[model samples]
Target: MSDALTLKAMLRPKFRGALLGVAVGDALGFPFEGSSHSFMAALGPDALHAFEAHRSGYFPPGQFSDDTQLTLATVESFLQEKRFSGKSLAESFLPLWRENRIIGRSPGCSEAIERLIDRTADWRTSGCEEGRAGNGAAKRMVPLGLWNYDEPERLVEEATLAAEITHRDRRAVAGAVAVAASVAYSLTRRDLILGEWIDAVAGATAPISPALARHFRDLPRFLSMGEKEAVAAISKLGYDDPATAPTTLVTPFVVPSVMTAFFWFLRHPDDWRETVGGCLRSGGDVDTIASIGGGISGAFNGIEAIPEALRETVVDRDRLIDLADRLHTLKEAVRSRRGA
Candidate 1:
């Protein structure tokens, strides 16, 4: 096969799956963003099947939130520059904020973009650094994973630049590295070994945050527990309180959100519905959690693994697939130049 065909044959579906997975999961969990664990759990098995928007009609069904908006913004910058540009990426986020179109915008992300738009901070200095470790940066990093698949060092560097635009806390940057690295690993492997995957992500993360690395390493132990015990343990990742509530929802804090996504993805690696739906029911930042989990599972499982109904209903389904194709094309070009 020609170079183009070979790369396409190997990567197109995975790219499509990863990007589409993020959007579909975001759309599916958007309705339950602030819902508590008890509320989501009370819905039981039906929660897995439910995919829609918030009831206020603020967003129609199938629309995604800022999690996906950021991802698309990242991809658009890469496509235009043919490489990651922190300035361009920062600029891309501005229109969303200026137009008042960003749904479910987190405070950290809102402040970062606001500063950039007002010229109070440049791309390098704009990140919310006052111990802000939200998952905003990590959730939109799948494109960096796709772009830097064969360049681990470059991947880390670019992931940092991409993340620090809105999240400068080292822990938050570590979370971004973990998510993007996981996607790269997923694309490279035909089959996933849970322990090996965890080790790889942990190794990549440790250089930035040992605490987050420890959390990644601890995932396998949680895997050994039954679902209820596992959810209880994982849900407490970033918190100190011992809860009396029926369940504790996963928060937007980087540690718990990333761990929750990883836990669910590990639990149901081969089942698309289970992986993302499990994140959905974990509650709290449901959209971001499921979107992260969905990206990993989709990269591993490919586009065909996602349910047809969800694919049909997700906002910007066609645009996401097109972005994937463009990313794949760019990946092939970059790899060919590097002789990778």
Candidate 2:
């Protein structure tokens, strides 16, 4: 509660804020995945099952789906290995699948996991033909940036490798790269000077792939546009597939998923709560959108700003905080080794 807290104290909360923010957003948005903003708002956040119970009878309340599970697995891998390896991270994902711990995994990811376990193909060729570009690749990518913060080239390299483990499409890789760069750059400071933040993320992300490089170059134009105009401009990319009959609120495509999340994150650069509210209002794939957006926002805001009620609603507070602490310790160790 003291303003006198050191940056070290502040950073532990920032670390925990990023991961716990992911979990809170995942749980809060899970039940509303396919529902529109208007419909969900009518029912309210509390009505959506904030507590851990079975309104759905299949997924328990406050239980995060595939996004947070894969993220934690990725973090666990880093904690064990001290660096990123796509094979090691992918192997870590296997136990979750085997134990039925991965709820709501995309069909593409599920197929790839099956092939991976079969040992029938290399990871680059193992991405399922269908849904190759779902936000699945990008949704869980923030931890990469946290591990390799301030190292743009390394962030892009590891993020691309992480995405290709289950997502072969160029767009999926691009989305993952952009988000990871944003998370990495975010941890470098806490001030929300909006232009600097977007520029930092764009610079970190732009060199990854030609497709993403071009996309990030044009990111500022969209981010600077009016909310409705930005969404309209982004929709021109066809990520939402609105032409499909019975259109759902969310799309699996990479273009709009990353753009929309970026739009809201930039808009609410300092408010995790407001950023999450905006993400939920944007609808489709709400959990994924909110998780990435909230994680970034929380990275800037730190954990103290996260609502106590929402914090309590998430399932694994202690373990998540411990994981954050471990990651912070690892980062300090690496920094010490470099300075030595």
Candidate 3:
């Protein structure tokens, strides 16, 4: 095959792998979200050992909550028009909400989605307040990145619009931009070094919020702090703390958690078990962290990089993979048209 065809072939599998990795990681970590590291450790002989999915609080095990559901909804909207649209996304989201796939115990997301359904609230203004910067929107944006792999700028723009459908906060938008950029960067580079990929994401996201800028700037310092110390530094900022500014809290916790997971994956690039385990051991925002880490790791290593047991157990695995394949086709079509 020609170099172009080889690259194209690789893109599809990477995109599929990345999306499935996110869902698998999310489902794995879903059962232990609020539990402490010790509590999680007590469940198995090793950190990544399989355990029964939690059924107490929200959705059932092997069933995705808002994270995977909203992601699928966004993918469905993208499929309808080959692009992201806030109105279309809101339309897509309502059906998921009606089906009870988007339910979570998070009050912020619940209220936002409810108001969006009533049409009483503008999706554009729904999360403008500083305190609305949760990881909800960012966690579901991996597909946007994959769909526009050759166009980092467009990926960021489309991701911002997709995020604004329910999370209009600048921090939320910035987080989506960062994650999308990371995926886009991963797709374009064939032999990406870990640090270079991180730098590429930082550069692509430079135009966003200053809070994100500072996090990227300090990323190396935090990386040097070791995983335990890094988690400690992040925990000091607290999660959903009403006292701290929303931007500040999210910047410290969400970004650091995601970055730390990526860093650990980079350190253990060839070891899927260790990479996902390190993400699970990171302590807070477990699902989001593992999802991001898994996406990056899967992109670099391909779908075969993910463990078969986890992949087989992923909720909606076939649908997610099909969506990813569709997104990859859209990406190539757009690239071809632009070349014409």
- List the lowest-lDDT window of 10 residues for candidate 2: 239-248
lDDT of each: 0.87, 0.75, 0.69
Q: Considering lDDT, which of the candidate structures 1 and 3 is the better prediction for this target?
A: 1
- Candidate 3 TM-score, true structure as reference: 0.87
Estimate TM-scores for all models: 0.94, 0.88, 0.87
Candidate order by decreasing lDDT: 1, 2, 3
Candidate 3, residues 78-163, lDDT tens digits: the string is 88977767777777877766666554435555667778777778777654355677776777778788776777677877888777
Give the runs in model 3 whose Cα sits over 4 Å from its true position. 1-3, 43-47, 57-61, 103-105, 237-253
True-structure RMSD for candidate 2: 3.4
Can you list the residue pairs that collide in candidate 1? none
- On TM-score, the leading prediction is 1
Residue 74 in candidate 3, Cα distance off native in Å: 1.2
